[model samples]
Target chain A: MNLYELTIGEAHGLLSRKEISAVELTRAVLARITEKDEKIGAYITVTEASALKQAALADERIAGGDMTPLTGIPLAIKDLICTKDIKTTCASAILENFIPPYDAAVMEKLNRAGAVLLGKANMDEFAMGSSTENSGFKITRNPWDPGRVPGGSSGGSAAAVAADLCLGSLGSDTGGSIRQPASHCGVVGMKPTYGRVSRFGLVAFASSLDQIGPLTKTVSDCALMMNAISGYDNRDSTSVPREVPDYTQSLTQGLKEVTIGIPRQYFETDGLDPSVFLAVQKAVKTLQDRGATLVDVSLPHTSYAVAVYYIVAPAEASSNLARYDGVKYGARDKTQSSLLGMYRQTRSKGFGKEVQRRIILGTYALSSGYYEAYYNKASQVRTLIMEDFNTAFKTCDVLLSPVTPSPAFKFGEKREDPLALYLSDIYTISANLAGIPGMSVPCGFSQEGLPVGLQILGPHFNETMLLKVAYNFEQATDFHKAKPVF
Target chain B: MKITREEVIHVARLARLELDETDIETFSHQIGTILEYFDTLNQVDTQGVKPTSHAIFLTNAFREDEIKPHLDREKAMANAPEKENGYFLVPRVIG
Candidate 1:
């Protein structure tokens, strides 16, 4: 197989054996991007010079006997994440040319791991939309269906992995940004337990809900990457104090008596796609046949997830984006003669329509007249949703569901219709609201031949247990083996 | 749940956006639909429960007012759209 197609596991084995140098692997990935990325639209900026320079250093270290699982591996970072010296755009015109002076905690973590960063991939502007259509840049298409959206926010990272443009990618999930794209692109996306990973360098969409996680070709790869980037970071006050575990160690152990819960509440008359339903059913059977107990559970307050998320996320966004005034940071369209004109002109030109819309709604929700009514009420609903998960997890180790109501839709299908777009993330957003870890793994394909994802969600920091079950299930199934024919 | 043009305009003002009449109606319809969909939250009962904002249980995470190593002035001003004499430049308000 080409280096681009090699799983992180295979590439690591080859690297350790001196079969492939990091520079060689990096060149192969860059070459593949040149050949294939035009159709995928997976990247906004490819830092070929910096990437090659990093790859060269990786080879030098490996030659001197220093190695990590990610050493020399080519990676695509979602543009919403900050990277030192690299233009850190939240896929918005405001930060179009803004470069951070410091690396994000994950960036520092990954660099120490010796990973070669390919460059920044595109996303929904300010992580605002359910589809990548909200990005100030061009649309990122699904590798599986060129005409369809690559789901979104983390859509570029997911597209990169699906198209084999990068070995793995880093994506931020404020709501369903990571998981939804992973579901649509037929890759693995892990939205870590909210505090599980630090948010020091991530561009905030929803302060409480935003998390940085890895998107990879397989669950095992995602787990490995998560291990590298997760753990305590003093720079991020929200970073958890829990001890980070080596996720790969327990992953191969088969699920013998683990209880995998099926939330029956998520399936009641919500107009879910029949294909996604079938795929999730098959996955449940696969888990059950592999000796895991199948438990029927209820997250009865689940339908409130989207409602809680939209209000809370926007409210947070409204505050976070206030830093982008023309006076201080980022780009400003300032031919305005007056100070107010400058602020108005700059912001109006900077943020995309979707981002502006959210900011407006959030500003009002948090305003004096309505703060208690809308934002506060939404927070209460959020509590109920998390409590539902808490109650469900008491009965079982993890919950299983479809990552999305349907697979990827046509590029323009949900662009004009915002509600239809929001509905696409119904199954995945709840985990974000609750601050839990969720994974979207390829399970099956629709009759239309597009891929579907079976979501596995677990309680906070139960990622090791979740990965064990996911890997065991993956080993028993061959769904992840399928690759797109571009 | 039914957000109006006035509501959109009011929110827009809070957000410091310069939207005209056309944008107000469009945003109202779009935001209205989204809010209506979220009205599903009204069905749930969140009685006497602590409003859970953060997923992981942690509190009092605010840091003390410590003067840490801030970025250099040149570094800070590197990305400023408009800068003047090591400061972020804006139209001077006071004469």
Candidate 2:
């Protein structure tokens, strides 16, 4: 197989068997990035020297007979993650030149696993929008259609995987940042339960809801990467302590008696595209044929999820992002001679329009006059949203829905209307609010040729169930076999 | 849905953003259009229903109150737009 198209498992087997060298594999992917990134805009920073150095070390480890799950594999990390001594820009102007002195927990884990770092992928400025157009550095185009954007925040990582620049990538999801992009790029993206992965050293956008996850071309590959990265870290107080199981071992489990819940309200909404509905409906048929019993379930608080999310996320972001006050590790406008001028100039010039809007709205909601009516109330409503999911899970093993309302749209399609862009995450936001695990896998395609995704959501810490059901559905359909055209 | 000039100015100030006349004119209309759509929140029956904020069950996680090592003041102030001695300097407080 061509180096660019190699799977993580394939690369490991070849490396251990001495059929391929780590330097060659890393060089091959670097060459692919140099050739294709101009058109796709997948990476903001390509670490050629560091990647080669890591590859050499990986080769040394193999020569010494020491191998790990990520040994000798090239992986792309979303820019939202911090890497010590490496420039981490979150695709925003504010931290344009910032170089972190500490490594994010996953970066440290991946390094210990001996993974070769390929590059830092682009993302929306602070992961604010659904479309990659919000990435101030560059826009990531879908490999399927250059005119359309790959979904945002993790868009660059998704595009990179779709274009075969890397075998796997780590992306942070606030509201479908990982899943939405994976759907657009025709890959498998998994968002583990809220605390499944550590957030230490992550460039915080929304503290309570943000999570790190894996995006890969297949379910097994995602599980493989997850095994290496998911675990408790002392640096991040929220990292869960549940035992990390062998997810790959569970992939072959058939769905003979598995009960899958179909949330009827998800696809019946007015905004859903007709083609997406047909695609998900077709996907459901395959699961039902696999001997999995289908049951209808209701998450009555679905409508309130987005409302609660907006208030809660912005409130968290407003506080989390306050750390970049130009007095610390980011850009500073030297011309501002006064204290207040420094604050205004640094922020006004550093942050983007959407970020400013959120900070403003969030600050207002948290203000004394509005606290009880907004922030406090949103917290109470958030409980109802979680309870809604908890109640649904008692009746079925997992819940399934469409990953997005529609396929990728044109560059300017929803840029003018921010609300329309936020609505794009309607189906996925509740998962974040409830802190459950959700995965998006290719289900079918729209007639216009864009890939459609089916989302399988499971209760907190029940990622194994989500992946197993997705793996079974994948085995039954050729949807994932569809490749993007360059 | 109609946002007044005063509200626009107030939000901009709260956001710590500097807005030109064009920005004010555009935002007043744009934000109004978006906020009107938020009427969807009101449409959902929330009466007597407790509002939710956090999703996870964990709460009030506390750490020891002992002072922790923070970034050095010199290093932290090095990136400031303007700094005077050990302090981050900005505009005069007098508004």
Candidate 3:
């Protein structure tokens, strides 16, 4: 196999045995990025100089026999995460020139693990949209089909992993940013329980909904990344105080006696493409044939998830995004004369149209007269959505569903219709609403040959069970092994 | 509920964003359509259900009143669009 095609686990084995040097691996991946990323547009920045330096240090550590699983592994970071001295644009022109002075808690962990940073991946501007078309820089194409999108917000991260531009990548999920794209790109993408991972320095979109997680070629690599990135951090007030498990150790080869719930509402939802339904159904049957029991479950509130998410996410976003006024950091508008004018012009020129729309929607929702009617009502209904999941989990260990209603769609398909784009996330938004760990694994392909994702969801902080279920499913199929021929 | 063009402009003002007339009209129609879908929430009788700001309940996380080293002055000012004398430059507020 080519060096660029090795998974994190395989590379670790080779690195430990001195069969390949860190610099060699890093160069191979960088060469792949140079060759393919121009057509794919998967990255905003590629740090060739800094990456080689880091690889040299990682090689020194491996030579000293002080290596970790991620040592010398080239990984891409979704541009939202803060990396010290590196430009962390959340795919917005507002922060296009902004470089953070500190590393995010997750970046600190990755740095300590001796991982090599490939560069910043492209994303939806401030993670506001479901597709990377919202990116301020360039649109990322699906490696499988150049005419299609690679999913959103974390589209670049998913596309990078899918195209073998990097071994693994980190992405933040608010709504279905990570999983939806991971599904579209045919890789393993996970979003941990809301507070299971720290959010400090994560360039907040919706403070209550965002969580950083991993996108990798296999479930085991996803688990290895989970072990590295998940833990408690006092820097973030919402990070849960819980025991961090060795997620890779939880990858058992059995699904015996496990009860998997099939949320009936997801299957019956309007606009669910027939091909996606069949693929997900086939995946569930594969699980049942392997000794797991499938139970029909109801999450009646599922229908309201998209509505509640639109209100709640935008409400938080308006407040969180109010910080960018061309004052402290980011690009400033020089033509404005007055203070308020600067704020208006800087934001108007910097933020994209979808971003502007959300800011307005959020502002209206939280405005004086509309607060109780829109924002408050949405939050109250959010509780009902959570309770639905809690009640369903009472009878099943995990819930199985489709990641998105359809396989990857062609670009400009839903670009003009905002509501159509929002409706596509119906299946995956409930997990974020309930603050549960959710993941998307490649299960089957549609008639168009685009990948389909099987979504597995577990209650809060129940990542071990979700990973085990995904790991077992991955072992049963060669779907994860199928790579996009670049 | 239908979002009017005037309301869209008003909300844009509150968000400190300057939208052209074309954008205001487009947003008014789009936001109105989305808010119409959100009206589905009003049907669910959440009479006494408490509003949840977060999925999991967390309280004020306090630590010992401690001080740690913070970002150096140079690094903090590095990304400022306009900076002078180790401080960010903003529009004049008073005559």
Candidate 4:
């Protein structure tokens, strides 16, 4: 196997045995990025020099017998996460030149684990869109088919992992940003329960819904990553003060006692592609054959998830994004004389059309006279949606569904229709709303050869159960083994 | 549910974003469509449902009043568009 194609586990084995040097592995991955990123557009910035330097230090740590599982593992970070001294653009022009003064909480953990940072992966501008097309930088293409989108917000991280540009990558999920793209790119992506991972230094989109997780080549690699990044930090008050179990410990074989809930509403969702439905059904049968019981469940509010998410996410985004007035950091309109003019011009010019739309939508929702009708109304519905999950989880250990309603769509397919794009996240948005852990594991491929992902969702802070189910399915199927022939 | 150009412009102003005539038209139509979709929520009878501002419930996370290491003046000012005397300089707010 090519050095760049090695999973984090495989590379660790090789590195520990001295079969491959850390520099050699990092150089191979960097070379792969240099070769493929131009066509894939998976990165906003490629930190070659810093990566090599980190790799050298990782080698020293390994030589001194002070290595963790991630030691010397080269990975890509979604651009939204802050990395000290590195340009963390969040794929927006406003912060195009903004370099953070401090590392994000997750970055501090990864750095301590001796993980090598390859670069900042591209993402949706402010993580506002379902397609990376909203990026102020570049659109990331699916490695499976260059004509299709890799999926948004975390598209670059998913594409980099799929194309072997990096062994594993970190992607943030606000509304299926990580899982959708991981599904599109044919990789394993997990969005841990909200607050299960710290959000400190994560460029906030919707503060209440956002969670940082991992996109990896395999389920076990995803487990390894979750172990390293999940923890509470006082800096982020929302981060839960709870024990994070070793996620890999849950990767046992059979699903004998596991009961997977199949939400009937999801299968009945309009526009769910037949191919996706078939693939997920086959995966359900595979689990059943593996000694798992399938229960028909109903999350009645599933239909309203897209509606509630649109209102709530945008409302939060508008408030959180108000910080970018170009006074302290990011782009400023020097031509404007008055403070108000500068604020208006800098934001108008810095933000893309989609971002501007969300800001307006959010501001309008929270505006006077409309707050009761829009934001507050949506929040109430959000409660109903959360209750739906709470009711369903009572009958099952985890819920199974399609990560996305369809396989990766071609670019420009739904670019003009914002509502259509929002509906694409229908299957995955409820997990964010309920603050439950959700993951996308490659199940099978469409007739078009695009990958389909089976989504496994568990109750809050129940990542171990989610991993066990996903790990068992991954072992039963070879769909994850099928890589895009880039 | 139909948002007018005037409403879009007003919301844009509230958001501190300056939009062109074309942007106003586009956003008005698009935002109107999205709001129309949001109308679905009104169908659910949420008479007494409490609003969920956060997913996972947690109390206010308070830390002891203690001074810890923080970013120094130089580092904080490094990304500032304009700065002088360790303070970020913005456009004149008053005459």
Pick by DockQ: which candidate is best?
4
True contacts kept of 3: 0.90
User: Could you give me the TM-score of model 2 versus the true structure?
Assistant: 0.95
Candidate 3 docking classification = high
lDDT of each residue in A327-378, candidate 1, tens digit only: 6778887588777777877888888888888888788778887776678888
Where does candidate 4 clash, by residue pair? Answer: none
lDDT of 4 at A53: 100
* Candidate 4: segments with Cα more than 4 A from true spot: none
- lDDT tens digits, residue span B13-90, model 1: 667788977778888888888777766766766667677667777876777789999888898788877777887778
Report, for every candidate in turn, its global Cα lDDT versus the true structure: 0.86, 0.84, 0.93, 0.93
Q: How many backbone clashes does candidate 3 have?
A: 0
- Compute the interface RMSD for each candidate structure: 1.5, 2.8, 0.7, 0.7
| Ordering by DockQ | 4, 3, 1, 2
At residue A429, candidate 1 shows an lDDT of: 86
Error of 3 at B41 (Å): 1.0
* Candidate 3, A1-486: lDDT as tens digits: 889999999999999999999999999999999999998999999999999999999999999999999999999999999999899999999999888999999999999999999999999999988779999999999999999999988999999999999999999999999999999999999999999999998999999999999999999999999999999999999999999999988787588868999999999989898999999999999988888888889998898899999999998999999999999998899997899999999999999999999999999999999999999998999999999999999999999999999999999999888999999999888888889999999999999889999999998888999999999899889999887765
Error of 2 at A306 (Å): 2.3
Give, for candidate 2 chain A, the lowest lDDT window spanning 10 residues. Answer: A334-343
How does chain B score by TM in each prediction?
Answer: 0.79, 0.78, 0.93, 0.94
